[model samples]
Target: MENKIKILLLEDDDNDALLIENILTTSDLNVEIIRAKNKESYLELLDKLDFNIVISDYTVPHFEGIKALVELKKRNKNIPFIFCSGTINEEKAIQCLQLGAMDYVLKDKIEKLIPAVKRAIKLVTETLEKEKLEKELIQFKRAVENVHEVIFYTNPDGIILYANKAFEDIYGWKIEEVINKTTPRILKSGLYDKNFYSEFWNNIKSKDHFVIEMINRTKKGDLIEIKNMISSIYDANNKLIGFISIQSNISERKKKERELQRAKEAAEEMNKIKSYFLSNINHELRTPLISILGFSEELMNEITEPELKEYAKYIHEAGQRLNQTLNNILSLVELEKKRIEIKYESINLTELLKDLINQYSKEAEKKGLKFITKFESHKISIHSDYEITKKVLSIILDNSIKFTNEGGILLSVRTEKINSFTHPVINIVDTGIGIQSEKIEHIFEPFRQVSEGLTRTYEGLGIGLTIAKQLLDLIGVEIKIQSQLNKGTMITLIFPTVAKEEEIKSEVEKRKITIVEEPYEKKSTNPEILLVEDNPGNRMLFKKYLSEYFIVDEAIDGLEAIAKAELKSYDLILMDIHLGSGIDGVEAFKRIKSFPKYKNTPVIAITAYGMTDDREKFIDAGFTDYLKKPIMRTELIETIYKYTYKNN
Candidate 1:
């Protein structure tokens, strides 16, 4: 388009030259013509600038047609040469064409010469442009091949025209296989809709480009998600050629997204369960705690005898034990939910066992059982969370003492060498009511005490093993058990030990801290406790038991509890579920916790409904602890000790 094309006309005859000039003049073309009357003149014209089309006579007096074409082709092979002669031979015409002449024109049919020349000129221009485009296309293809994304070209009929190395790598198919295969048949995942592809093609044709996400199958039959951008290609005449597509493998990202969604759903479901259990636990605990506290308080204040006061103390101790069990249950839930942080340390196994033995001596003596230690190592240390390990050991020993009557409990420890590392094993053998054959497998599960009916009579929350199991899991320890129905139970624990111990020198004796009790303070020693209840007997008994610990506050319904908690500074609250009045304890706990001042204060639950999941729900609703009625004095004391002593 930039340079004007020049034309060379060779005709020794003046009349033929005039006719050719007339045809060129009448044609719609922009070209400069040069006439060469002799061989010398033609050679001189060749030395000049370039020509787009050459018109020469076949039989000139001095120069021959084929020779002239050969010379011109030798110089510039791209320039189109046409023969305009009255006596043109078929062989010569064929030779000229083979030598790169565009076409031949007859002088006798001068009218056809202009049309022939015009077509030849147009073709020359088109061929030259096509050659330029082909060069650019080669460069573009090379660049696309080097790109990281899998690039491919395909026709409307779905036959692949070209594919890069990346495409072959992604599909596990060779370039030859992909180039000959149809798009859908080769890589269909059967995850796309017919309408989806229809719309995809429509957009690509109409808008020139389209982006989509689809699942595709590899040659190996592995399914992968791909993000693709496809664009339609066109030639100079604006004719549709094919499509060029670039894609990336997104299977890993899709997997992560799906896993995240599942985790979120699981968390939501657990939260709902937690809420339900919390409400039930709170109602169960508060009812008994109130009874134990109130009855014991009244007896101590009214009896006025030292011997009678001892009975009240015993009641208090029983309530405290029940409360301790609730706290431990809550702690297990927190551990399972990863709400608690454990501090890791290097601990001496020898010292740890000795400490546990000493702590459980008094309890074992009360149960009329002796504790025996089998020390496999006089000095052994390992890397672990010392406090948690101690708790685990203490629980096993306590359970052993609780169930055993006359037989002694044995604790043993040893180490095993395992391929460049040492593993520690601890065994606890108790001569107690051993686990039943069917119950052994599920003993570690929360709220499940053996069907021996011992739990109902014995003082325990049946959650100690649950906590121990969770704690051991956190530290990568495995616990195994072998038991006979009524003879004895042997529990084994295995854990990896660290040789290079980072010795912890702290000698802090683990003891429960008690807050300084202010006797003469004007503040009520018995803080007002809200008792939201429905049953008249239960409410009366709850008030009677709790009178010793706090000022008994009454709320016949959940609405009353919420209203009272909003207006008063009750130190603690005891909420009952299934109130005869409007709203339930669950709704009441939510409303009470919603208030800023009551958020951190402990709220004990008293309910008849108790389940493994109830503890988490109660805690989630802002209840500090939960107990099933009728409450023991030890349980109440333990729950009070947790909140009161913990705050202190």
Candidate 2:
């Protein structure tokens, strides 16, 4: 582009070389010409020096213009090579052009030399600029390939225009496969909904950049989470070109976050269970102790001869109630720990209900409530862990009796056929102060009462519903409740029932109450025994009355008695089923029967767990007799003689 262009003149003919040189020299255009006589010298000059254009003759001594042009190409592929022929032929000129010569000039018509050289120089300058740009393009491609993230360019219509090796690697696809495919159709993992992508585009159109977490798919169809950043690219005229996206895989990070959330939820559930246990345990232990202390003081004072006996009876009843609470609490803990073992058996629902109502009718009468029992038919039976179900039902019905003040408690069992199987539905409805709306949801929650007001007025620990809920849940029975504040609460328990041959045999056996021969012709020299246990205070009260007739051992826990089995031998073991391990007494008897030495031993399971299932579980776990805790002194003595020393 500068003045005085340096042109290399490679012509073997002296006349042509001189004429071309003079043509350029004489014109107003200034140019310096360097002459090479032959192809050898022209190529040598080209190697050592740069030239603006080359003017060469078509015919040389050893090499023609075509050979020299070929040699010029070897030296600089893009340099202008013009052939000046003495007798230029159309065929040769066409051949020159085909060989990539810039132009063919006739030496006789030297006028065209200057103009052709000027045009050649202009074309050569443009060619040089294009080569420079190509070099830069190769460098940029390498930079993109070297990056760790996937970097790609997609056209406005979403066809992938270009992508680096990393992009191909990240998607597990070859470059050719992804080059022209639309982004969404090829790589979407369905994690992004319509709104997600809609907002993505909206932001990009407004702000020219987008960043988001996306789940993308690979060529192999594997899903991966990625963090992507996209920016709009443009041309020099500010027209839309395409977009460049930079993405990094974040699949592992997303997985870790999900795992952490699950662990947090599990910890919260365990904490709730622990909190309930602590509250219920304290209440169960304290209630019976207060009753025993209050009644024992009255009896000790001997205020009235008739009242003294009544005070003693109250102490015994309180002790028995305390013991039942302890057992329930312990059993629940064992169930939570996954330590309770279940024995599945077939049971008759009708007989079980009758026995439960018979035992609880007196207590309901004492509370000024009528006990109503309606067993529709005896045919319905359930396959379950008899002991557990009995305990669960007992807790439910006991709650009804304890809460209802004046109205009658109704227990009804009906059978419904659904899906060709009989479903036994048991309902225990009470006219007690119904659970408040908000508190009803949590009534089955341990130690939770309807109100602080209700807790103060209620004499028992708030574990009956909790125990019922847990036991029913274990046996796949669903317990539902309906209640209105101050109106009433009705609990419905649903259990699957099927007719079985074994249950018929058990029913027939229960119907025949036969007398067995006595072990001794006369009562043993030792007197019959009854054991009463309530809270610690009630335990002392029962001990004073019962110790007069038989040897008595003490236990604060059902667990302690089970442990003490090896140290002492007794004709019978009396267990308070509701000892505040609340269900613990049931578990203790279960454990004792599990051992071969104690499996056949006579055990009298007594408690507030006097529900139908409570007695069934006690018997199923190898108890010879069952009694409700809070023993009546005269009744306790009479029942003892019936079981322990039957001979008259």
Candidate 3:
């Protein structure tokens, strides 16, 4: 604006151009006048220069002012143009003005020329500013109309003043039906009380904005959930003019949330029912099965006649098979529900494998298969959940024995650098019926058997490997299987190496079970034991089992056990959990252990309640140890001896 206004002057007569420049100079307007002498010069100068205004003679030598004005407009649409003629031809002046000239003036009346030029320049500046403002307004309007959420503006009186296309599309209302035709009452579903409306407006006026999930009615009479946001709109003077509302249709999302909540409740109810069922199954069926299995095992061991012994063996074997199948089913359920808690501690993998070999070798012997170990010298100590680790390895070894009929199943161990860490690796290679290559990947999936339908010969639930794999994952132990159909399968286990022997873990291992293979020598003086059991058969069977080592006493219920303990504290107490419903074994243990003589005495929890959490639950209840029933004589004797030796 500080620069001079440059004018392109087109006039053949130098006198007229000089006069115009003098007039501008006299008016004290800052001006730079560039003259084009003729029509050719005028057109050429127009192409070469830029100017704020153009002043041209109506009667040039070869170009009329009309033609010059039209040509100037072709190049610059908004530049101001004025006509100056030597003769006072009124008709020609009018014609020049009609041909896009801002103003036309005669030389005799030249006073009007200067004022016309100034007014024309001022008008052009105002028009350009107005056009720029209008373009911005159009863009803002387009953006508001195209948004997905419903947006509307209202006057301070709450009457709807404006609404976007989204309002009609989302709320099921036409534009004409809503705008200035109704209040907010049209969208209200009457679900909210009058207090809700009062708070809605009060909060909006008090705070910067208000947001809520509101229930509203659509034009089609369908109720919907809306996430409504409202804020105040203000004028330039800071007066509240209207309110702006943004509503998101969240009906579908709300519906899904309700459905998910109901599903969660239903699942929880089913779990409660399942837990009850499993609890009953563990107590009712297992309680009698324990005594049956024990007596059958005793008969098989003591019977002299071959035929009678064979019959006893058959009963014992069938019970063992049923027990194992039940265990597998329960384990599968716990694993699927993700309810098994892993308690990691130091575990002797060497002893673990030895136990598995001892347990399964007889089964392997029945089929004339060699079950052997190659790493007895290598005492592999590892950090893992001892119970789960044992279960995982036992499952795999049991499957190996179950599948293999003739050849050997070998257990071997070695050291290797796996992932740059030296880990002790145990490999169980079995020369049994191997898996098909394509089926190996799916063996870890539950109930996915390699042999399907009636033609398959193997007797199993097909969840052994699935449970094995899941337990391994829980303990962070890695297992891999390699097999060829009908050749052999080799399973590799990489263990978490045990920390140094002196480095104790954060929590001491309560079940520090040392598998001692050597037989225990009997002491001359026997320690007495109190066997509290309600079932007559279980009482008889347990007394018979414990009589060889301990001077055993009996109680048929929890009250009797407590009464007996008040008289004399036994060296050890085998407390049965469910004792004919007369204040169960756990409560009796608490009372018996309160006596001075029995304060630190070993009170073993003997129960058929062997659910996934049962052992841990009982152990945490201050039992010296826990034994799931149908307990064999050897294990029961061994558990008693271990506690007595520790007490002694």
Candidate 1 per-residue lDDT over residues 1-648, each given as its tens digit: 556557899899999898888878767766678899978888788877667788999989878878888889889887888899998779878888888888898888878877777787787779899999999999988998788789988886667988998997889999987786777678888787888778766677775655566899998999999878788888899888888888989888668767866786798699668845854685589678888877887887788788988989888777777767766856765664556555668788898887678878777777788778887778777667888898888888888888787787888899876433467889999899888888888998777786536445456667899889878765656688899977989999877545332210010011001112333233564456677787788878776666644577687765567656655667777777545223447666877788899977778887754445667767776678887655544355456545654432
Q: What is the lDDT of residue 217 in candidate 3?
A: 92
Per residue, candidate 3 scores C-alpha lDDT tens digits across 378-407 of 666676788998898889888888888779
Candidate 1 regions with alpha-carbon error over 4 angstroms:
1-268, 272-307, 452-459, 500-648
lDDT top scorer: 3
lDDT of 1 at 166: 91
Q: Residue 613 lDDT in model 1?
A: 63
The better-scoring model by lDDT among 1 and 2 is 1
lDDT of each: 0.75, 0.72, 0.78
Model 1, CA-based lDDT = 0.75
Worst 10 residues of 3 by lDDT: 504-513
Best by TM-score: 3
Query: For model 2, what is the alpha-carbon lDDT of residue 474?
Result: 60
Indicate the residue-level lDDT of 154 in model 1: 88
Q: Is candidate 2 or candidate 3 better by TM-score?
A: 3
- Model 2 TM-score relative to the real fold: 0.39
